[model samples]
Target: MMAALRRRDFLFGSSLLLASPFFMRAARAASPRIISLDYGLAQTLIEFGTPPVGLIDTPGWYDWVMEPPLPPGIANVGSNYEINMEMLQLLQPDLIISTPYLEWIRPQLETIAPVKSFPIHAVGSSPYPHIIAATLELGQIVGQPQQAQALIDRTERDLLAAKAATRRLAEQKLAIMTFMDARNIRVYGPGGIFQDVLDRLELQNAWTRRTNEWGFSDAGLADLIGIGDSRIFYMDPVPADVLAGLAGSPLWQAMPFVQKGHAQRMASVLMFGALPSVSRFARLLAEVKV
Candidate 1:
């Protein structure tokens, strides 16, 4: 009886060993080589534990609100608008992820590989939902469903916590804008990432004026004063000279909010006012002194 039992155990172990290679091959076949064109998509890939082989805007990895540097082995594919076609052809990625706004570049990129676009900034598309959907969609394309779900769950929890922390200050009226060099300024109006952040905090957007189709409006110093009396949160790092210029401008200095010291400077996180993820947005809010 003992001999028979030993033989059966040996056969079971051998069977698993024989099947192991097939399972390993199936697992290896699951993960696809992906090229990400958007910074948000690149961040999603990292969250999913399957970073892209090549990415546009590698510097964004460090400068981004999340501040996680890209791994050394990853290749830079140039700017989002100007991808290196030669390098992309050489890499031959299985999938290319981009934002819907870059649809104009689709024809050129599709020649290389399958391309997927997420309409992150589309009308009525909220940042949190868009990021979650994009991450899950990319996971399906790259065979990382479990990782994608985990990231979404984590993001949701973090956002909820941040909201709870700031619940008491929900009544604050906030305005987010950026100085464009010395002469022009861009302000986020309704239906923008900054607006979304303000909405989450239950704060009001001072600027009720309609922005361009992309949710940003250009204004001169004189026009900015007309926006509202809400405490202004200037996005992006302004140079000392620009700050001095604003300080000297009668139009800027005379603004009630500015004169009352209700204006503050913020680091440029969401360039163009698109929050990539909850993690990024939460970090932006966490760093806000006021």
Candidate 2:
């Protein structure tokens, strides 16, 4: 009886080994080579443990979204507006990720590879949920669903912690703006990622004016005078000469927030990026001495 049982087990094990190659092929098929057409998609892909085969605008990516540094040897596909089609064809990516902003070129991208467009900044929708959903979808594409869930859970916890830490500032109005030039600044308004993050922290956004579909309005320094007695956090990457010029300008110095010492410069964050960028901004804002 024992000899018969051993023979049966040996045959079963051998059959399993013979079928392993088929399973391996299926697993490989699921994880397609991915290329991102923009920084947001590239950042999401990297966060999902599926670093893209190539991406556009590496230098701009480094300057704007600095965290989760790109791995060595990531090919530069081209600029965001003008992708190098010849180089992209050589890379032979199985999938290309993009946003609705480039819908006009979707047909062109489809010719090169299967294009998957995610509308992250949709009207009447919160970007936070969109980001979470995108991360999960990308994880499934890369066959790392478990890792994706772990990241989402961690981000929620971190955001909540930041919210708790900044509870004291919740009652205070905060204005976030980006310097465009000496005379103009782009201020974040309701329906934008920064405003969404501020709302998550239970904070009030001081900029109540209307903004474009992207959630920012281009306004002069005089426009900010209305956010009286509020904390103003301007993003970085401002030219040194611009700073010097602002310092010397009496109009800038006369702003209500500046006069009250509530205006300051914050670290540069990709205001439109996903979890990592949001988490970075939240934690930094909470840590700032206001």
Candidate 3:
């Protein structure tokens, strides 16, 4: 009887050892395979060194939100308009990170996994606070609260360094815009993420015109002329056609800032981004002397 009992226990122990890998994978799957549908959140997660299992529009994300690069093998679920729900389901994710922009598809996504919606540019609330709060919240959710705080602290340090470097030019009124074409421009104004960064650095915004809740005004060259010699900084990745058209346009040449040689071009920076992006913009501004 004693010999039989010993053999049974040994067999049970061997079985457990053989089954451990599968059990471990199941536990890991239970620990939330987060899928970020938003670029800002993806960037945030990457900055924290926790790349999501899935995200939307990986190619566009690479183009627009360049920094804090995504890790290899991240699954691209689909576009913002239509998520590849079939692919998402195949991943068997435990969580789906999203924002209000995906409200239309939230219900469907929730059906796959517990959807965690973060209002990035929520109504009536500034994005700065939301960015920090969201970062912390995400850290807690992902079991990396320390990393999130460290990233925020590091970003703050970098911003302060950039601010000190640009102290002499802090008071310079600046106009930052991105061109959709030769005629149309989206100018960043008050209540925008850029404005919040400028405010933190004690910089003044040149475009005082009222903007939409998203904190930008879509207007023509006529609207931009009012900027009146403030250092004009345009974000890059300008369409080749737009650049060519602007080169020959009489009105563009006649603009006061253009005539005064105040216009300058900076590399692509995401207008709606998180902490790392804001830090990047600050560094870019400091590096590019107006």
Tell me the whole-model lDDT of each prediction, alpha carbons only.
0.67, 0.77, 0.78
Cα deviation at 175, candidate 2, in Å, is 0.4
Predicted structure 1, TM vs. truth = 0.80
Q: Which of candidates 1 and 3 is the stronger one according to TM-score?
A: 3
How close to the true structure is residue 61 of candidate 1, measured as C-alpha lDDT? 62
lDDT for 137 in candidate 2 is 73
Q: What ranking of all candidate models by TM-score puts the best one first?
A: 3, 2, 1
Candidate 2 least-lDDT 10 residues:
17-26
Candidate 3 C-alpha lDDT tens digits along 147-260: 889989988998899898887666568899998887899998776788888888898899988887787889997788888877888887888898888779888888888998
- Number of the predicted model whose lDDT against the real structure is largest: 3
Error of 2 at 47 (Å): 1.8
Residue 67 accuracy (lDDT) in model 2? 65
Candidates 1 and 2, the one with greater TM-score: 2
For model 1, what is the error of residue 278's alpha carbon versus the real structure, in angstroms, after optimal superposition?
A: 3.1
Question: In model 2, what is the error at residue 137, expressed in angstroms?
Answer: 0.9
Lowest-scoring 10 consecutive residues by lDDT in candidate 3?
14-23
Give a tens-digit lDDT track for model 1, residues 221-288: 67767645667878656656788788677778888788778788876665432224445655566556
